[model samples]
Target chain A: MHTAEVLASRLGLDIAVAELERLFSQPGADPPDYGLDGGHRRPIRVAYQGVRGSYCHEAATTSFPSAAAVEAFPSGFWMEDAFSTLESGSADRAIIPAENSLDGPIDRNLDLLLRHPAVRITGELVVPVNHCLLAAPGVEISDLRRIVSHPQALGHCERRLQSLDLEVEEVDDAAEAARAVAEDRIRDTAVIGSRIAAKEFGLRIMEQSIHDEGGNYNRFLQLGVGDGPLYCGENRKTTVAFSLEKGVSGLFRALWVFESRGIRVTKVDHRPNRANPVRLVNRAGGVELAQMDYVFVVDVEGSELDPRVAAAVAGLGEFSGFVRVLGSYACTCGA
Target chain B: MHTAEVLASRLGLDIAVAELERLFSQPGADPPDYGLDGGHRRPIRVAYQGVRGSYCHEAATTSFPSAAAVEAFPSGFWMEDAFSTLESGSADRAIIPAENSLDGPIDRNLDLLLRHPAVRITGELVVPVNHCLLAAPGVEISDLRRIVSHPQALGHCERRLQSLDLEVEEVDDAAEAARAVAEDRIRDTAVIGSRIAAKEFGLRIMEQSIHDEGGNYNRFLQLGVGDGPLYCGENRKTTVAFSLEKGVSGLFRALWVFESRGIRVTKVDHRPNRANPVRLVNRAGGVELAQMDYVFVVDVEGSELDPRVAAAVAGLGEFSGFVRVLGSYACTCGA
Candidate 1:
């Protein structure tokens, strides 16, 4: 065996890699038979939002290295288009950003995930974010007058950019910014993006790891079409989106179900209710007023199909205004 | 009373303005007396980040219209500096953006609020966000090559900007962008900011209300030096920041305190634990792993001083890992 394979086996990570490669491959031309040992027989086509050098592309490749093809779909700067690729059957799976360590949750993507009932998260890839300042050949860091990248990227490196005293511009994504700088050859400009992008665009690296802090990471979710696969043997994490009924005790009751079963929650986030932005509540003063509505998203340490977890989730129907399982996948904690 | 005064009185907004104006006046000539009614006697001195025409300035002026001076502090494009002005006794109170309707919680501000224990949230201001396209004299929309504003602002108007086909730039704030355009006489650039900024910067309103949604709004918080004054006697909102014990039922127990008393929670947000980013736990398989640590921030209806609310809060000290009352003030619901 190769040195890498030896290391993987020694670390007990070989099963994870093998499982990911096998599960991500395209479903065979024949209908899937769950009872069969290994389901898919053909290579899978994985879709990502940006061009080849984007973070999503890198995540897709890393997650499914054995896939036949990794396709790039222009999302018009919106992640929903990437999901549509999976929905329309053009790609077997889609990878997209779910959260960032420095930037918190990508609210837009979470909202889209909640809206698209057909797509379910199957796995997660946590990519260490290492941003570099890329510029044209022969360009030096001090030579750049302006820098451009996604707004989040600029914000992440706010202190460093302020120190450099360069005018910053915003674009749809870091890869797109790299592409723009390369095509236009803006001599006085640099782009903050992945090293892969710098190599792809033939640009010199002005600086590496320019973000405010090291160890910053972005978590991307692998989404597949349909409900979910059992995958019950391994430890798992389940994601569920829920909305509370119109009562002070609604949220408390919903959380109780999980706690009652000794399940631990990993994260919790709530967003404004898009369909009903506001609800009318009658105050003690006998006045009806408009208050914001919201939907809560939670991730917990267990599989939705597990009997204990299922019983807890079924309890949600008793008090929750709405609840749906986003996905259940093998736990990749500390990976 | 004058027509405007009569309208303000009828709307019951006069007290808020009067209290704000009274509380801010002498950026701090004396140590604050928590028990004193109408704490400060002179016209208030308020501080906000960004230049004159920025949203923070607008919020400050709108919240305390009768203040002696609304000072703009250059925070190096960071909100923490504005908080420091209050910490150093230079500004009586600092008004800053806390959250937005479209963008969810302003994560940076939330993190700042968590870190600064001396600064307490005293009140909140909800400002309707109306972004305008500002340009130099005689400049038209068609003449623009680039548009500039805060990243969040740019994202909010993404569709409109895409159709305009202008190179988008990121600046510290919209007002700063407007100032730059006015100073440089950049005929090929326009700024997306408030109409107030256009007037303040000697720029023409090339277009008004260019944001994708008209109902877009941002929530700003009023920060004061210490815990809170006894603003008892009305329907009120209490903001609290706390960290739960490392037990599965810790969060559920905390929420139980509020629900048991029939209090309603309006908002809930949790941020990663800054001091302790992660904790190592031994799983059932006897494997040690890293798990994220979080601090929960919650806003509930009813004053912190209310007997029932006080009882619930007191209960937290017994089971919570850590608990702190951010502040309590009259509820500004529908304001």
Candidate 2:
């Protein structure tokens, strides 16, 4: 049994055992999930978005419990700063939220990842979200006329907020929302955030676990500099983004590059090409029409170091307009 | 020249001409970009999210200007109500935003479209988004300490908001934000929304065309019921969702169906399978691992009425774990 499985069994968490087993089956693919104490010579510095009580901070902690330091960056344009920190040798690694189990992918982060070629994904972490409704001292639920929190947290507690008949508003961060309620003496408002946020801001916990779903989780990725495709250790997973050449069979031919190699693709996402958003072609007739130019982001099992994976990517270059390797990372199992 | 192109050339709008040409090339696939007065039998009833000055309202107007009634549904869970309105026979059709030029796909609407099989897309409309900064009569840019609007609108004007150094807040709708500012008489805040929203709320337009990009646009789909794959008039495009069977080449085989039929695929998007998010399978060494299950949403250039397209969709049954045709629609082009 793998360490993650053992931890899952011990904690009675609903982690995917079989997935974790496959991920760890590679000779050196095992992740240091418990802590970073065993593998590295020196402590690692990691950067995450928001203040101490933010989920990004929690995710950074969950990814590297014994790191040298966990640094917090401001939210606005912080993803770029986090990547820049890694590139400038200020931080060893950075963690960014990729998607939420309930809400799906985060658009801004996805766009940032696509734009930043310097950073590569090295690992992933899934953090279970538990939202608590916090209020000022001596204020009850009925006294709250409006609710404030991060957009995602507000979305997570949509039902709870609706039931409370509170006007929902969104702020930059949930922790900041709690701080505002505490510092501004806003008695008519409540904030939905982590219990740590309530404690940090000295606010009362009006309600606990107010999220609509109890098993909701957010997936965060560990990003570092350059193409360290070998970071997956024994278990090899590679992520690549590419655009297909112009032809009727262009999309199919591109997918064939991996399918013919017996490589299993885990996910595929398409984004419009920013530089040339629309493709125009002259048909046999004199008709001019607009076509779409899209870049496909795909995850496949096998490290870029593997000859088969390298050949498959090379094969993609034959028919792809643009091909880029995003990263190779060992899959971290979670519910 | 198509009506949309004429309107675009007249307004000097940044609509994608080539795409519009291809879309209209189909004998009956042309959409009335200016108004719905040309083809309809009687005054159509349209339903959209938010109040009169909202984007949804604008999309509905662009779709059908001579509608009998354009009804507004609450922003939260509005898509469901829009579909329900169509399903319950309260409205003739509903239009929902599918994707934005600047932002990626709207996940909630995508999921809703996938979930609700009762509604089928008959046509599509692309509306340019012109974001304006609105405030009270006496308020100026320097006087604003905070700004409130819809999340997407806020995101569109991120650079402008950052430069102003205002406390950004998000409400359910951009129009609602304008209304809130007008009703609450918030002296130190502004709203980023449509000029129509400002007019509706009796607020002053502090700034015009404040979007980060000049050519921002959103694509909205026209939906009805009962698989009117034949509704495309002379132009026909089909949208289908399918999950590949458990095999290395399952995905490739599914795409081959369309490619072999000489059909051009316009777009492809993959979403995590909600029913079975993670798939566990046995590898060559009899070791079990967790794999992922995803459903692909694809757009192809032929209507279901086309025998080739029908055969291809039918062929999907051989290798797809699940398959569903979302709708067939005539495309309206925009950047």
Candidate 3:
């Protein structure tokens, strides 16, 4: 009997033994290829938004454990700066938070991905978020009158912060908020940030893991310039963005191409097409319908190099106004 | 010849005449029912985040032109407060921004919608966003050292603001930024906001329509307590949220039900399932896979009362762990 089945039986879990066997028998359980060449021509540098102790910085370091340097960009407000750094060849890879389990998609990065066509998503890292309330040393919880953090972090801990009854202030970065509290000696203000930020800024962690719920995770994507390498593996996931040629049945037909090919779609999202924002659909009664054009981004369970995936993309091109394969990378098994 | 055909031919547009005819022949182009009882029980009070000059305020007033009272909530940071007002019977309706053309989905409100099950979306309005640069009276543009506005406004005007080379500060609301500039007499800071905000706050318009690109719009949804009325119309659009019982072919099968029923899906989005955030998939080799669970939200081109839509939703329930019909309302044709 499989170890998983034994464990499930012991735990009285209703999971099927056949499903466990299938999952274990799946190939390509190896670590994902981040498209890094082995030769060390120069020290590898990864660029990420925010200062050294931010969650993004932690994502960068964790994604590239042995990287020689992790460069920090001052502005967390704009994700474009990180993309530009990668596009300009200043950094080997740029890591940006793509989505939060609680807050959903980090849209600014998604928009930047569409805008920067050359940048390819090479790998993804799912970091468990544990927001901490940090304040200056010698400050008690009762002394706090206000709380500060990034909008996403604040949102993650909204219920906790509301119970605290502190005035909430949003900044571009959680580490910046921690730095402000520490450097400015704001005894009355606490920041919702990471433990790393508290340690780096010499601030006391008043509360640890203060997020509203357990299992908070942030998915971060590692982006590299151009098409670096094709991931050849069974557990590969390909992301593509496309716009439909027709209105009503466009998306249905678009997804049909994959379904007919026996491809499994993992996720689907839509973003407004920045280049072609509107389409004027004129009617018989002179009623001009200005419809918002959308670019649908989908993730399928195969690499683009796979024959089936290639054929499915080619088929998508038939009915789509435009289709671009963003990237195909090995899927991470767990957070 | 139809007027649309004549206009298309004169403008040298490659639009098909048959398509135009079909569009015009489509039924139900009447204005939507806002769910107002048309009784004088009490002044129709609508609650929205931000003050009178904010975008949410504009969406509320525009959605209900004859609303006697528009209540302003102080906290624009949290969308939950606006929803709570409607849930607690403090307001008859609540209006909140759903999506922005350039910035994409307003995720906070989407998260709030999932949390507040009792609140139902009754109507929608697409407001054209015309952002302006506001500053203190008699303050020249050259004298400004910093710019302040809501994060979305700052993002929309990023390119224009980058060209100005001023420090940027993000506030909770654009109107609040304008108010700060006017009330505090901040001569060195300009704000990216609306003309309404400038007029209300007594700030001068430094520049008009300062957004980066044209066709800027914000889609707003009006929410009320419970399912007030079943929209019975040809142009009705229904929004639904569901979570699949299985993975892989789950979403495809879900969409297939709608497509087979001839229901046109207008939009698709995914939100993290807060109640059940993670699913533990155990494998034979003792590899435990913790996958993030998601709730899929879809908008289809029919009301729940429509038999076809109802049948499709029932079909969805067969394979869905959870299903919710958020609302059905008349479709807004243009921005």
Candidate 4:
């Protein structure tokens, strides 16, 4: 029997092997209206964390091309402010980078997702990151005595930066660094940022794609008001966060629920539960052991509307102490 | 039946309930000599990332009190340099923060562990982070107009700083920020750092424990040369990193191997496989789909010396494309 057939029989679902193959192969169909009203009434306002030329700005504009305006929050350090703006109805949508291919998850945003329960993921956008070395006009790379960029950007281009033998300064944002270089007209310094930043600050791109590795990408998420719209598509992803009631077996059982239904789990991230950071496990003698409590964020390849997916989530209640479905969104990577 | 009895029976291990209770209750037994030879021949040299009064420095000195010298790399951005210092035999051991109770994992160090295969973890240390607000000797808290510290430190004290209404400047390290504040004699600026930093720079503590949450802690890992020694203790943690050969089911199977062996998984972290960031899944008729490949780092509560652990790791070979046991260290969290 085919793998899907076995799964279907076990789950008592009538899904066919061909259907499963198609669902697994596609990169998510076009999503339904997600609270923007198809942009018919007015252009959607999107809030992003960074200056006008930062990567987040690029992601926002790229993902929502017809957005009325992409407002900037001061820095990545203040991502909460962006979420707050969206929650306050100042912005119809908010965009934030969920993870970078090289740097991994932007953790603060993940924490914010849990903190801001009213926000939901509406879509995903994958942007290829190409770091550019920008300097004042007519300033060559050899004339640079120092380099400045966000710490993560500097870290990404560490190998190339080391070879250049220049002093490195860490800044809050890459675009901000570009702005500083342009405003100061520092002949002895270059900044590592994006091409958009270079253009925005009227700086020359001395070198392009200076990062050490190729294929660097940042995955950005579009967020809207709670449960704005259900994404009805064959290729979909449902993100959920849950904490176990007790014991290590709970995690295994939780994963088993999805696995038994042939649901493909795309990603799993564990964060220390802020409210209950540590749990004291007590034995019969009252001796206590401290164990770190965790909030698990999992992404599985199925819409919440799917019968098998719904059944699996229901099954999770048996093992999970608390569960929250963050969103069921189209898997619109590279779109 | 007791939980241990049920677990032992399921796993076919002869461990007793009382013994299991002891194992589960203790932090970890005093670790065996881990190739330091009791520091008899020469004072053990330790390498850490950051300046003298940085948190990593405190963790190093606190964890290795008998070390002859604790050397500092430039900053956290140069953590790989610390690892390289260890790999090149310039340092006997290196210590780096693995995770913060609030900020989550120090991702670059986790990536370094996978990149540098020779460095093995020897022990773990937990340090309570009490961020102090320090200023010029005569400066009062009300006199401050700006705050300078590491980004993470600023983040930890965000709530307090917001109420103070001070401008925040993010530097690479908290100690570095303190140094700048002292050297520049910036009376208007206060820095958030450790008490050690304030003392090192001749600054006065304007406020103590200014972080938003009370139980802020950083978990540090003591790394030594490859396979230095086996930690024989009732409470132990074995960390391993692996990537699957094929489908998502492999991860489920990998976890099942440990769950079946009655080993409790304490932590699980996922990162993109650098060499193979994305895999192309192909079906019939040349239909292809791109999937992000991941490197999973997991910590299980058992030393590699245990037969059950050995069997579980052996079982991983059946499902994993690549696997490496990073370390089997004593679970000495508080110590």
Best by TM-score: 3
Per-residue C-alpha lDDT of model 3 across residues B1-335, encoded as one tens digit per residue: 57965654433311221222122223233322323233212244567776767877765555543333233443344688778788777776677778777667776666777788998877666667878899999999889999988887888887898899999998876787788789999999998887777877899987887888766877777677776655465456789999888753488899988989899887778888876666665644564555567898888877789999999999999999989888877544433
Full-model lDDT, candidate 3: 0.71
Window of ten residues with lowest summed lDDT in model 4 chain B: B12-21
Put down candidate 4 lDDT per residue, A1-335, tens digits, no spaces.
Answer: 67965654534311221222232224343222323232223334567776777888766655543333233333344778778877887776677777877667777776888988998876666656778999999998778899988998998898999899899999877787788788988899898888778877899998888888655777877777756546456457888888888844367677878988998776778787777666655544444545567788888887888898899888897778788888787544443
Worst 10 residues of 1 chain A by lDDT: A27-36
Q: Compared with the real two-chain complex, what DockQ does model 3 have?
A: 0.30
User: Which has the higher lDDT value, candidate number 1 or candidate number 4?
Assistant: 4
Provide the overall lDDT of each model, using Cα atoms, as 2-decimal numbers: 0.69, 0.67, 0.71, 0.71
Worst 10 residues of 4 chain A by lDDT: A13-22
lDDT of 3 by residue, A1-335 (tens): 57965654433311221222122223233322323233322234568876767888766655543333333343344688888888787775677878777667776666678888999887665667878889999999889899988887888887898889989998877787788788999899998888778878999988888887666877777777766556565456789989888753488788889879988887888888876666666644554555567889998877899899999999999988889988876544432
Tens-digit lDDT track of model 2 for B99-156: 7766667767667778888888777665567788899888877788899888878888
Model 3 spans > 4 angstroms off? A1-43, A64-78, A130-213, A247-249, A281-289, A333-335, B1-41, B64-77, B132-172, B177-195, B198-213, B282-288, B333-335
Clashes of each: 3, 14, 0, 0
For model 1, state the Cα shift of residue B165 in Å: 10
Candidate 2 chain B: worst-modelled 10 consecutive residues by lDDT = B12-21
CAPRI-wise, candidate 3 is acceptable
TM-score of 2: 0.69
